[model samples]
Target: MNNNNRVFLVDDDTDFRESMQWLLTSAGYDVVSASSATEFMEIYQGEQGCLLLDVRMPGINGLALQQLLQEKNVQLPIILISGHGDIPMAVNAIKAGD
Candidate 1:
């Protein structure tokens, strides 16, 4: 299958990741999920896609991952999701474009 337009999901919650995978799949998106940023990095091969990332995780949190991606010049678009995020976090995410 073509790699373009695939959706890369990175989150620590199994249930949330599965649910989002199901939802995105049901909507006809090609979905690839990983339990963490490290796992995602292992599987990703510079494919053209958008990322659905969790903001708070055990290691290499969303912001840190975003910075890492920036440093590597990865061009995939990222959407940061957080259930417990506050105003400051949201502001920071917006400013960081993640």
Candidate 2:
């Protein structure tokens, strides 16, 4: 793992997000988290890192967020996580080149 590696975690679950932040930090990764896509966009500035997104977030879902990032020419790698019923959506997002 790169020492300067960072992760942008976007999820609606506060507990999950906090837990992930702690786990990533303990693993030597710089982690930044947001409760919604809107919040993430407010803070993201084309930083060099990967995006860990929850597919079912409120106020702009993960796929939509990926599209917005693409529109803005932000090419960071994205990892989408979803519940069982949301797997199709996640697959579609990946198939769409997110």
Candidate 3:
């Protein structure tokens, strides 16, 4: 994929967030990490490019966040990552709605 302008990442896992933040930043992609859906939304508003969203989180999950994005008419490309337990939900989320 082309080098995007930015990547908004939201996950409650601090270690994972930090690691991925480091990796993406080192790769020269402007990266922002969020610990919850609210944080993601805040960052999303400021982002100029794509997004990387985690499926499970406290205070509103990725699926719900995706819905919120749609309702807000956000057109950014979003990549979703989820644990095994969230697989079915994630699949449904990817297929079923906006």
Candidate 4:
């Protein structure tokens, strides 16, 4: 499979992550999953693709991980997913991209 076709899925919810992985795989996307931002960081090796990130993980939240990725200049695009999200959080996520 092409490296660019991979999807890095980072979420604390085991069920959600696995479900997404299964769905994406069924859709023919190469999916890589981790339970937390910390685990994602530990396993990620500069792969080129999108990041499907959960917004409320334990160790590092999605926003924090996005910031860390920015600091490290890792250019993977992020799609934030939150079961409970507010307007401020949405605003912050948008602003962070700037």
The number of the candidate with the highest lDDT is 4
Any idea how many clashes model 1 has? 0
Q: Stretches of candidate 1 above 4 Å error?
A: 2-4
Ranking by lDDT: 4, 1, 2, 3
Task: Look at candidate 4 and tell me the lDDT of residue 56.
Answer: 95
Candidate 4, residues 25-92: lDDT per residue as tens digits? 99989999999888999999998999999999898899999999999999999999999999999999
Location of the lowest summed lDDT over 10 successive residues in candidate 4: 10-19
Compute each candidate's TM-score over C-alphas: 0.93, 0.88, 0.82, 0.95
Return whichever of 3 and 4 wins on TM-score: 4
lDDT of 4: 0.93
Q: Largest TM-score belongs to which candidate?
A: 4
Could you tell me which residue pairs clash in candidate 3?
A: none
lDDT of 1 at 85: 90
Q: Please give, for residues 15-93, the per-residue lDDT of candidate 2 as tens digits.
A: 9899989998999889989999999999998788899999887889988998988898898889888765465675688
Candidate 3 Cα misplacement greater than 4 A, ranges: 1-3, 85-87, 96-98
The local lDDT score (0 to 100) that residue 70 gets in candidate 1 is: 89
Task: Give one digit per residue, the lDDT tens place, for model 1 in 1-98.
Answer: 76765999999999989999999999989999999999999999999989999999999999899988988999989999999999998888888774
Rank list by TM-score = 4, 1, 2, 3
Candidate no. 1 TM-score: 0.93
